[model samples]
Target: MADTGEQFEASASAFGYLFQFAKALHICIEQWMSGDMAWNVAVEAADDIEIHQGAGDRRLIQLKQRAEGVRMTDLSEDLWKTLRIWAEAAKADRIVLAETRLFLLTTAEIPEGSAAFYLPPRGSQHRDEERALHLLREARKASKATKGPLPKCFEAFDNLDQGDRPLQSPLMSRIEILSGTPDINEVRNALQGLAAFAVGHEAAQAFLARLEGWFYNRVIEQMQTPGGRPVTGSEFDEMLSDLQRQFRYDSLPIDPDISDMSFDPSQAVDQQFVRQLGLIGVGSERIELAVRDYVRAFTQRSRWSGENLLRAGELGKYERKLVEEWRSRFAEMAEELGPEVTEEEKKKEARRIYRWVDLEARFPIRSGCDESFVTKGSYHMLADELKVGWHPDYSARLIALLEPARTR
Candidate 1:
């Protein structure tokens, strides 16, 4: 509901410090992973604030610390901004920045309302600031609660580079003790492993579902007749192959589970096809009526198969009636046209009318990600190549439709 641009700006500012904290944590984790006995991990961007530390080549170990109000989904903005700033800073601090390997360390799971940060600007800066403050406080409290005694191994490095000792001395003892153990590695490995498993399972399930849907649709297509007649076995296969060839789907493999199932007798013809036919200025309704009449004629003929004469008569009578009705309607509409209109003008007029009707009948499909309809505008231009058209006034209309009335 908020303006996306405004949301981004506000969220961006509030998460800036959090991003710095995450970077520091990542550095500590990496040192821990490398089995370093003595290492210095400090948030040394604008200030040298010690957050965490561990021993040798700790790049493999990552740490992610977040405050209470920070939502899991909302963390991405902070993460991306942190990376961007780090990259810029790294470029400037070439002498100080020695490592390229960075890992993510987190103690919190992504929370609900986390997605708020990703929303469009909605002028909610005050709210976002409040959330960020809450998260920072929570994170600090969590860190303190989980704090352990300084590892004895880091005591030696406590005196390294005395000129910078004053600022780093307080954290040295704690960093050394923590770095000596493999607790950080255990935690990081467990979280990463679980995440990888969940992602893999989800992807596999989605792939299977898509495959099943395709197979089912193909099987249904083979059993149904253009005129609703039932077909079986070899007859069905032949028809299916022909249909596939017509649709340029010859390369698709046939699945036995779906290949033999009979078509649903209750299924009606798709209205989309009917709409397409109408787009060319054809009398869709008249065509439908004619088709229905033709089917009825066939039904009656089927009842008396031996009597060809009777069937012929019935078919002829229905055909003549359809023709007569069509001619009458055509003549009446033609008479309404001005006498000055030429044959070419009428054809052009029909085309224009058909196009207008088709456009009016078309509706855009909404995307799940942004809750916006597909359109040929800026959004579509930046989206995937296969873009769909969305209503021009959809955003305004949707907002109005969802607006709650104010109480007196």
Candidate 2:
């Protein structure tokens, strides 16, 4: 079992990570809306979040959040730690000073007469790089004579300021401290405000949830790659535009996750739709595809219903159309077969009907619901309920199989 202090530290660390991730997401949305097209955001690359224009210019941001009313004093650990990381990066040439801007965003406020207090933008009332540098130099001197993390931070800071190199001047000049920065909730509200332009008030919550879901997944994909391209502003814009088009009056949302979902035919082999395919002598590979479409359609419709994207009796009406179309096709196939059909001939004709439904059928639930799975899988769903089937004798065959269990 872990000690109480260790547990507290672990929980605090987890909270810090959550805040950092949330902050990164909030920053991405803001930059996507207004930042330059050339700049892209990278997570855990050069800093907590780095907005860079290729290999040349960068905005390295460090985020820190504390409990309410906590002021970032001159000797604060968060300030020193962030400075140490940036200083070490500069000293190591991992970042070029000439084309990089450093941002320290914190929920904590910096008081008057502090080093950070003088390090806001130049036009601010107390903005003074010289004064800030002087204060930092004094702080470094004081820290050098002490023990623990402070000395290490000051050592990194001093390393950049040493000799004729004097990198700290340019570095300090580029530093911008965004004190009393908005917390996570405020940032979420800001994102929702931006989402309103794409999707109106009623659908904003669902739209934002889905947009953030995609954005987070995209960020994770980028993070996992060793040296992948950063998530760009353009990608976010494209994704948002696509999602906006989905929410339009004629269209419905297609979940990317469901579209790419993996299917195991074995798990659904006993299902009625799979049995219907088997009765039509559909091959194993084709049966597998049918099961996939069925599951995707079922899950997608459930999502639509849960999200309230479908109207009252809308799905029933859609299914009725599907059943009606299948009925017409089945009747035409039956008439062609006549009363004197061999088992092999019936099987071949059933396969033809199934193929037509699989390859040529196109009944969109809505004018804009263009995902093929929704229509294809919904057919399998109807087949599952015996409302529609590819095989001409699927009902009689299924009833014969069911009657034995009923008698038992």
lDDT of each: 0.33, 0.83
TM-score of each: 0.19, 0.90
| Top-scoring candidate (lDDT) | 2
List runs of model 2 lying over 4 Å from the truth: 1-11, 53-57, 141-147
**What's the alpha carbon RMSD for model 1?**
26.7
TM-score, prediction 2: 0.90
Q: Which lDDT tens digits does candidate 1 get at residues 49-146?
A: 23223322322222344454444442243333333333333334431233332333343444434322222123434224344434432433333222
TM-score for candidate 1, residues paired by index? 0.19
